[model samples]
Target chain A: MDAWFQNEVTYPHVAQEVLDAADSVRATLPNKYCDPEIAANLFAEAIDEYLLCDDLGINVICTEHHAGINSLLASNPMLLSILASQTKNVRILSLGTLITLRPDPVRVAEEYATADVLSRGRLEIGFVKSGLSEYASNQASPIDNGDRYWEAIDLISKALSHQEGVFSWEGKHFTHRHVNIWPRPYQPTLPRMWSATGDPSTAGDVGRRDMVQVLVLRGPEGTKTAFAANRRARAAAGMPKPTTDRFAYAALVAVGDTHEEGVRMGEKLMWFLNTSLRSAPQFGPKLPGLAPPQAAPGLYRTKPAAAKPGETASAAANAAALMNITAEQAMARGIMFAGSPDTVHKQIMDFHEAVGGFDHLSMIGRSGFMTHAETSKSMTLFGKEVLPRLKEVKTVTAGYNQPD
Target chain B: MTNATALPASGNLLIGDIELEVVRRGVGQPMLLLHGFQNIEPDAPFLDMLGDHASIIAPSHPGFGRSSRPKDVETVYDLVHCYLALLDSIPDEKVSLMGFSFGGWLAAEIAVKAGRRIDRLILVDALGIKISGPETPDIFDVFNKHPDEVRKRSWHDPAAQAPDYDALSDSQLANISRNWEALCRYGWHPYMYNPQLKRWLGHIKARTLVLWGASDGIVTPAYGEAYARLIPGARFETIDAAAHHPYLEQPRAFVDRVSRFLKS
Candidate 1:
């Protein structure tokens, strides 16, 4: 199965652990990770190990974390350069760098195109609107986010594909010079692009464009809802129904020799994420969105029961109550896949069947502050046991209608 | 409008001066199926899976099976352009496109260029992106040599591996070789398609679905996820036990997934 390694930190010691874990799972799995700098360093180590040891198909997932307040300042372009120089066969992906936050689409296009060339054309770029914190930190208004996103996408696309002259764009969010990027990507165009979205409307918008969408699994039913919405939007736009081949889903995974062991590990990880991580006194106050408590607890849960008009004091109160109820229900429903390899495999297969078909599956073994060893064991079990069982089922057909 | 039941039982459509034959069946919303490099027919296993829901159109790409070969069209881009023209010839204004294996690469190109006109696009075991993982077997190693070896390379379970390749006839080998050469001609570059295809993917305005055979040997599942992440509003599903041809290996699950997607 295709497995992605989530790089939560950039420490060298941690990087080595992740690399070692990746090596163990490499026999039965494909490994992917985020963070450009860490990826660059880890990739170098991985290549050496791979050459000396057995070859493992490990990939790096790079993200333009425009969500961070100091992202632009913190981002290291040199890391990408290092990655390009260090690795030969691994694919490098810009999981996405926010398009809306940057005013110059040409610059964004040029940077990614350069990266693609540096990586020998293995780059994939994902576009997203900077998170709320990014806008707040940059002192930008949220009203213009969507407009900027579309504009940036247009400018970047034109600059990458149309080779002849400088392409000028006049949009509400950005106006750019008539300058085309040099040294276009190795492919006829730049690396393939995908837009990441959380909302149905956004998913629909991406669907209508026939672009790739990465739907993060917030809850058990979230993928189904998003997939259905996208299909409907595409159909309503008078576009042909999406083929079943274009769907992808992400999940949190923990596998063990026995169901009890898996549950204990998953629970420990969740507890650490929820309680142990130290928070700066000013962190919650400074960034309201970052503080999970500030938002309704159940906001990410399944379809909440609609509030009866006038039943609650305000929408916030009603949402809070609904969320609590939904979380309880989800817990009872056993939505989270935590069990033995056989049980986990069955759960995943059932989930795939329930949501129709998904082309890609991403699992995050490290949740909150789980250790590298914990994550490694989980990944190993997944690669060895869960993946084998998943390969037993039939291939999903190409559905011509939108998903509901 | 002609209903699905009323459609003629004609053979596949032979298009282009090259006489590229495409099998067309059923009616209603148009659905096109593009096969990969294996030279397998869009047999009952595949057609029956998708036939009942919409008008099914399965084409045997040039240089594969019985389809007429195009002397000049060498690269994947040429194949993509040809397919775009084929869609324009169809009576329907827009049709859903599904590409398997190499066909998936062509489908991505078509979706990017045609955008909204193509409607929905599905890519299964697609080979466009240059992924960093286990080196995919060269076409010669897969299509020209022992077919069972190709299957074993991908199939995780010993039971699922195909039988001895020595028993295969000469024609099967010829078809395999021809298709492999075609694939190589189109996908020789380390990163199969334009690196910028990822960036251009955002421009496509059609709903997309990336379907994969979980045990696909040619492309890793990580590559599949990369495709999903690259396409906006795209969804990904992995079918079990299946290798490159999920439609052939896991027809029921494949049909169920497609049926649900179409209905939704």
Candidate 2:
């Protein structure tokens, strides 16, 4: 079972004084008044944390978001390249790059391929339609996002594939001539491709493409249903049935010596969820044209509806709903896994049983305003006690997908 | 004045792969009325008013209203060619052309491309030219404002601005959303203005009247004047006590000025 950690370099020092100063001037300061020095440290610290995870048999997944207070990581390719250089053996996944927002596909192809070569075939290309906020910030028309994303993926995939001779692309959203990518990927074929979404409708599309489907923010039942539907679609496509290896889930996690310490540490994840999730509503106005007309409302409701007044309410509600549970509720619901090493291990096993088991467990380690030492302790404990005990557990969905 | 309304004959005109919904009324010289980004209803009072004069051919731009928008029709240039085809198909050898807001920009584009087919041109607060002086707010600002705030900028009488959204049918709502999406497809990239449009404005030889709402904040009257100055023989006129849509706010004045210009 490959373990992965998804992280963003969130701004470190969000002082009330700086916020007050910004509010006095009536300026909505960029990135929650992030001090550049603090942000720089956070970036370096995040890389170091990933390096630590490397030592612990955990792979790294770097993702991107735009114009948000919490997320300081806006460029996935740039971060992934750095990860490629710093880490060895551990796979580096963008999990994904915002494909829809990118204006140039050739550049994306070149950058990711470079990273793949740098890592010597230990890279996965994850493409995402991204969120509405990115489209708005980049001033790209939201209505064309789906079309643009699919077109971009096609262009990038072909560019990376080891097709001999020069090729050209003529897509509705992009057109390029003389397309021979230099420094082709280390792998003969393109690296593994991933499509991340909360939308069930995309399951068939992802399955048809034979790409891994990474489910985000979906609870156990939802994950199971989505995975089953994807498997069914692939089977219907006459492709091999999908295994748990073809699926991955993201969860907020913390581990400690005792349940009480775990719970206390888990509060930091709740803070991260609430504060980071609050920016979700601002993505709506930006998505007017991005989503299909009927699907627009679903995009907003992707998270739990919020209680706080105005835009942040839905995001806050989503966070609160996810984290407000008792440990028992958490275990049953599979919303989060936070406890002692034994408890956390059992909870993961139970979740695996419930969802029919997925291959990758993506832990969000450094969340909210949690201190480095606290997250470091959680990581150390997870590596020391949790991972070793689970080594003997057999793959649950292995061989479900027949090999090509 | 007749209390009864005369419903225009509606039909679909197949221009290549596109099926354009066209409404025509009153037999005379053909006068094509192109609607704004937010399309006017088929039975809008202004259409009825125009129906009393020249033969009115009001067709929704492709991807708007009941029209079929083919994927091939991606840019404003595609729309211009489509309108040109519509012009050629009409019985009149030379037809008067009038377009509102986005439609006005289309009319201007058409005039620049094929001005010989246009006998006269009228642009009502068109949104497709970039001006340097007296900073003009991008038409995309309407998307950022509250619907009511946008309403205030769109009408002289605020009472006329309140749309009972609940009363609208599902199709009406869908059409409204589709209209905005189409606008985004055509104008969102360059932000509602064609940067190269100014260069081609000199090519338009049709006797033109560039109309504006005197109090229009959507695109200032100064912007309208700049639009008029580009055309060699175009006249500029601003209707008083109105915002963006003078035809909706002050119908009689709008019809009178437009009719007088087309006649002269």
TM-scores for every candidate against the unseen true structure: 0.45, 0.87
- Tens-digit lDDT track for model 1 on A79-98? 45555556676565565656
Clashes of 2: 6
Of the true interface contacts, each candidate retains a share of: 0.00, 0.22
Tens digit of lDDT per residue, candidate 1, span B88-207?
666777788888877888788888888778777888888775544356532223322233455675555636545333554555545554554465545544335566676777776788
Best by DockQ: 2
TM-score of chain A of 1: 0.68
> How accurate locally is residue A17 in candidate 1, as Cα lDDT from 0 to 100?
55
Question: Could you say which candidate leads in TM-score?
Answer: 2
Mark the 10 consecutive residues where model 2 chain A has the least summed lDDT.
A307-316
**What fraction of the native interface does candidate 2 get right in terms of contacts?**
0.22
